[model samples]
Every structure is written in C-alpha cells, then in structure tokens.
Target: MDNQRSLWAAWAERLRQRFSFILQGQCALCDRPTSQVFCQDCTRRLQACRVQSSVLQIAGLPPLYSWGYYEGALKQSLARLKYGGRPQVAEPLGQWLAQVWLDSGLLERGLVVVPIPLHGDRQQQRGYNQAELIARSFCEVTGMPLRARGLIRTQPTTAQYGLLRLERYQNLSNVFQVGAALQKSPNLKDIVLVDDIFTTGATLKSATETLQQSGFRVVALFTAALSERQIA
Candidate 1:
C-alpha cells in the first residue's frame, strides 16, 4: 500500500509539473520563459511600493497595515485576479505578501486572519472573492487558521467608480454585518481583517466598527495594497 501511494504521489507531482509548464509560456509582464507567474523583472519592479509594516490604529477604527500603494505591475496583477477572474494569480502574489509580513516580523500574537467578506451577490457575480483567495493563501503560508464566518456584507453596494469621496464612505458605512454564528473557539477577540486593497480606509473603518460592536477587538487591517483613487 505504501509503495502504491508513493507511485501515485510521484505521478501527481509529474502531472503538476507538466501542467505548469504547459500553462506557463511567457511572463505576463516581460514575456520571459520563467516558472514564476510573473517574471522576476516584473516582481522587482513592483517593489517601488513600500509602506511601514508597523501598526497604525485609527480612532474608532482598527489598526491598519497596508502593504503598499498599488501601482505598476501590482495594478495589472490585481486587475487580472479581480476583474479577469484569475485565481492562480493569488498563489504567487499572496505568498509574497505572507513573506513580507513574516520578514517584517509581523503577524503578532493572538493573530486571526478574517478576510473582508463580499456580498453574496457580488461574490457570485465575480465567481470568487479575490480577498478571500489571498487570505486563504496567506493562511497556508503563515499556518494561521482562517475565519470567514459570521462576517458578511448584508447587501450589494453601488459601484464606487465615480462616487465622490464623501459618498464612498457613506455608501459603505452600514454595508457589512456581523453573522449570527459568531460563536467559535477562536472568536474574533483579536483578529486582522484581510483585504485586497484599502482606498479611503472607509471599508476597513466600517468593518472595524461592526466587529468591535460585536465585541471582537479587531486589532489590525491588512491589505495587499492601497488604492490610488483615494479621495483627497
């Protein structure tokens, strides 16, 4: 039985290798023949965005930790993953994000990773929640268990594309809702809200307020990057 299992495992590994080579022809950014989803050149070019990993607590809002400003290759990558329905993109990018947190010596004590939940309708429309994918990958890399329950968007929100700055905040003010099944061993007494981007900090603020009201002491907000379209 063990011998048979090893043979199957080896075959699976070979299959995966072949599949990867088949799927990956050229770097999306540089058109290089690299195993990396994004070529090394593109990865290095994305380093222009760097923000302090330390905590920044907002009044009446949870402490926020933005990886950096979203630009260059990051914008393209996120667009591909978010709008283009690319799940594979989350693997490399999310792993890099976890490494950034680990190298920074963050992901502190009593850490819980709660992805910002998408509205059910929106999630269905998108086919998957990009933030959830990143959070799942982050958990796999960090060994931190993920909690996606009880936190949800109560309803669909209007498009934020051209909304005024003030309107954006107002639109998301009461968008999220705490799930009734907030009961769990690792309840959100201490958690880090995960998301793909932080624009006006409005979404984080709103989610923070809801969690705190539910007595979950949300300590931090972690986003892959910050949105450049933030209202001035």
Candidate 2:
C-alpha cells in the first residue's frame, strides 16, 4: 500500500510539474502581474531585509533573511498556507528564499541548509513541517544539500506567540533536539539554519545549541522574515 501510494504521488507530482508551464499569475508578495507570485519590486524589498539587520547577527547563528515583513499580502499568504491548508504556495515562497540566498551571497558561506523541525505529533497533524517544505525547494535550486530530517521539536509546548520575548525563549529552550539529519550527513559543520520566521530568536537559538552540542559548527539563523525586531 505504501509503495502504491508513493507511485501515485510521484505521478501526481510529475503531472503538476509538466502542467506548471501552462500557469500564469501575479506575485504572492506583491500584486504586479508577473509569472511569479511576487513582482520584481517586491522581490527587491524582501531581498533588502537580508542586509538590513540592526545587529547583523546573533552568536553562532546564521544571518536571518526575510522576503518581507509579516504584513500585507505576505502575511495573508502565509496565513492561508499555514492555517488554510494551501501547501502549494510553499513552492513559490521556497523559490523566493532560494533567490534571496543566491542574490544575497548566503550560500557562499554555508553548505547545508537545515530547516527547523516539528514534533512528531505536529507533523502527523499538519502532514508537513512548513519549514521543511521551503527547505526542500531551496535545496533543489541552490544545489545545497538539505538536512530536512534533523533537529526536531521533542515537546509540544504552548504556542510562543502569546509569550513575552524572554518567555518565548524559555518556552522553546527545551523544545528542539538534534535528529537523524546529523547522523547521516557527511561534513555536517557550518550549517545554515533555516526557519520560516524569527520572532524572539529563541527557537533557532535553542536549536543551534542542540546542534552545537552534537558537534555542528552552526553559523547563522536564516529565515523568511523577522517578526519582533521591526516593531514600531
């Protein structure tokens, strides 16, 4: 049954790829009528966030790069995909990350991209880790190996959205653990940690510690956006 299901999925994915050329649409981040979801201007804006960090970086974490703030159409798009079950949007968003990385020189310093992982229960519920979806797409384009299976959230703690900054850090301190991605990858050091967004920078920080403890020379925290840092 599993093999049959896999065969069907492969066929479906092939169909989607073959028919993708017939697609036409505007940008997801901006409203301009372009083949991609985001127009060139909007793409420029998101790419700019990569070089504009106030502090440049956190210790031992990769630089965070976002396509845009969690506002306007980007926010709604993320909402639809994250909560409304529109997983297809992930492909374009992933492409955005890949584009930003290449244009911004993020890949010049790092070889591996590891997406933040979800706990098994959450994976069962969502049937995906949104981070992994983006990472998989990113890996395909950048020619960088993606460690999608490593670093898991062992505990399902309360959502960090409601917690204060420090509280958010404390809440996630014990949440993530290094997974099989480490055991299997060759030359695992100097990894670029990828996540969808960085709010308090706690989740990525904790995950970095886990990987470092397991001997990875993590460099920076890279993401699609920065949430708490840009408050007015």
Candidate 3:
C-alpha cells in the first residue's frame, strides 16, 4: 500500500507539471515561453531600466518617484493592464514600485499609501481601479497599510490622454475630495499617492492639492512609469 501511494504521488506530480507546461503562455513583452506574464529575464531587464533618480520636482506638488519610463516593456505591460483587461499584471508591477518606495527611505516616516480614486461610473465601467489594485499590491509587499478610500472621486472627467497640459489640470479640478473615513481619522497624517503612470503631473497635482487642503501631507507620488517629458 505504501509503495502504491508513492507511485501515485509521483505520477500526479508528473501530470501536474505536464498540464502546467501546456497552460504556461508566452511572456507579455518578449513572447518567450513563460508561465508568468513577464518572464524572469525580461523582468530583470525592466528593473534595470528603472530611473535612478529618486526625486521628481513638480511645481506646487510633492516630488514624484517612478520605477521606470513609460516605454518598451514597461509601457507594453501597463497598456495591457489598463486596456487589455489584464488586471493580474498589477501584482509584479506594484511589487517593483513597492521596492522603489522601500529604497527611498520614506517608508520610515509611517506614510499611508493612498491611490488616486476613480469615479463611480468610470470604475464601474472598468470593473476595477487600476491604481487601487497597484496600491493594494504595494501594501502587501511592503507591509504598509493602504488607505484605499482615503480619497474619493466625486465627478467623472474626460480622459487626460492627448489633452494639453493646462487642459489636464482643468479637467481634474474639483474632481477629487477627501473621503469621510479619512477625514475622521485624526491619526492619518503623511501619505504616498500611488498611481499607475505619471504623464504631465496634472492628476497627481490635483490630488495632492485636495489632500493638502484637507490637512494631510502628501510625502510623495509613487508610480510605475513616468513619461519622458515629465522626467525632465
């Protein structure tokens, strides 16, 4: 009976491996055979391309820190996450952002991770807030608490893509407000605003101003990718 059980276990393991190989798909970036969305080699290369600058200065807003520029593998991965219905991509990407946050030494300040919120209609349409997903994963990896509802989007606005710099700011104006729970939480002070991408600093600036007006200090903006123009 013992020998039979051992043989059966071995056979089951073999079958599981075979099935896993069958199910494993190509890497999202390189098209190489990988069980994960991004293979190990591609992931390392992506990490290597990350921005060495830990501080990004934007007028009237907290400094931003991004993992990499929005291009190549990073851009492709984010596009899939945002528009391709591949929400699972947020995990590894968020982990990378979390690592950046950890290395930046701001984690010692007891900062709360707050993701920029999506309006009810838009969020419902998309079925998920990508920022929230990234923030959740960030907290999981860093062991920091995430205040997912710290901010609320009271109104929906036009998408910022292709909009001029001034237009982007105007579009987001009066769009975000502090959530009631965060308002009532007296202990909450410092925050790290998490977003998927930083384009022109408009969205983050608006969110920062709103939070600051509400008596919270935004320590920094954390994002997965930053546009080339914004990098300068």
Candidate 4:
C-alpha cells in the first residue's frame, strides 16, 4: 500500500510539472509574458534581494537561513505564491533557496528536510501548503530526503499577518506536535524545517520546541523570505 501510494504521488507530481511547463503564461508578479512563474527582469530583481545568512540573528530561531529579504520583488513573489493561488511559483523560489544553501557551506550529513505544516482546515481551504510545496522543490535540488509530515499542525490558530509579537507567539503556542512520520523513522534526526516566510520567528520557535521536546534536533529554520524588520 505504501509503495503504491509513493508511485502514485510520483506520477502526479510528474504530471503537474509537465502541465506547468506547457501552460506557462504571464509572470505571477508583473503579468509579463514568460515561460516561467516570474519573467527575467523580475527574477533578476528577486535575486538582488539576497543577503548573507550571517546578517540574520534572531534571538530565538535555530540557525536561520533565507533566500532573500521579504521586500520588493521577493515579497510580492511570496504573496503571490501564498495568497494568489499560484503554487507553481514555489518551484523556482525553492530551487533558488537550494542553490543558496549549497553555496553557504552549511551542508551536513544526516539532516532531514521537514516543512512546517498547515492545519487540516486551512490546508483544505488553500488546496496546498506553500511550505510543503517549497520544501518539495528544495529537496529536489539539494538531493536531500524530505519528510513532509515530520511535524503537524494540530490546531488551527488565527492568522499571524497583522498580529503583534506577543500575539503571534500566543497564536502559535501549542499548535504543533511531532508527527507520525518522525515517530516511524527513529533514525531521522537533525531536522531542517522549511517555511515560506519568516516574520516574527514565532512560528518556527514553537515548531522547533515541539520537535525538541519530542527528541529530534532541529538544526536550522529555512525559509524563502525573511522580513527586514523582526516584526513584519
């Protein structure tokens, strides 16, 4: 049964990729004609937003790493991926993040890629979890094993968009638990949690603690975008 499920999932992913390639249209950010999610100009702009990982020093996050700052093209791209019904956008962004991680000299053995999950209700509404989508692409490029369900969101908390720091922390508290995938694979330790955005660090903090309490070591928090301000 598990083998069949894996085969079907691989087939579905291949079909999705083929369709995305064939149906390429306007850039998600600028609506300019392109064969990819973002046009060449927008892609260049997004690349320009890259920063050294050393610059991001949040007080409570695990060895944070992000592809770009959450402003300008990078910000718009993430918004389009998360809210504009464009899951295809995650492909290139995740690949770019993988490239950055490779160049950063942080690659290590025995690390598993785990995407921060969405609660079932919200995930059902969104049709997909952006973090999982991004992590899929990340794992594809980096050749790392992806445990997409290593953590689960057990509770649906309020959206953290406009919430203050205290509110964001409160909103995410007790929302996550180590998932069944981790339980089944006792050898899968030293996690790298992937998410689409890093705003106040609240979400990752809660997730890291949950995994830690469950006997897993969360080595890093990786994201596609990082807010320039601690509170975004």
Q: Against the true structure, what is each candidate's TM-score?
A: 0.79, 0.74, 0.87, 0.86
Query: Residue 228 lDDT in model 2?
Result: 49
Model 3 over residues 1-232: C-alpha lDDT tens digits?
9999999999999999888877897777676778887899988878776886957888887878888988877888888888877787888889989888888877565678899999999888888999999999999999988888999999989999989999998999989999975877769788889999999888898999898898899998999998988766
Q: Which scores higher on lDDT, 1 or 4?
A: 4
Computed on alpha carbons, the lDDT of every model, listed in order, comes to 0.75, 0.71, 0.87, 0.88
Regions of candidate 2 where Cα sits further than 4 Å from its true position: 1-55, 228-232
Q: Write model 2 residue lDDT over 147-190, tens digit each, in one string.
A: 88777788987777779978888888777777777777656677
TM-score pick, better of 1 and 4: 4
Q: What is the Cα-based lDDT of residue 91 in candidate 1? A: 73
Q: Higher-lDDT candidate among 2 and 3?
A: 3
User: Per-residue lDDT of 1-232 in model 4, one digit per residue for the tens?
Assistant: 9999999999999999878866778888898768977899998999888865623656766778888888999888888888889898999988988987797688899899999999999999889999999999999999999998899999989989999999999999899988888889899889999999988889999999999998899888889988888532
Q: Pick out the ten consecutive residues of candidate 1 with the lowest summed lDDT.
A: 50-59
| Cα deviation of 146, candidate 2, in Å | 1.1
- For candidate 2, give the lDDT of residue 83: 72
Please state the error at residue 175 of candidate 1 in Å: 1.9
Off by over 4 Å in 3: 1-17, 23-33
lDDT of 1 at 122: 84
Model 2 scores a TM of: 0.74
In the range 1-232, model 1's lDDT, one tens digit per residue, is 9999999999999999888877777665556777777777877876666554434555666656666678877777788888876677777666766876686666577677788888898899999888888888888998876777657899788876678879888889888877644556444477778888877777778888888877787766778887655312
Q: Report lDDT (Cα) of residue 220, candidate 3.
A: 88
Off by over 4 Å in 4: 1-24, 52-55
Consecutive 10-residue window with the lowest summed lDDT within model 4: 51-60
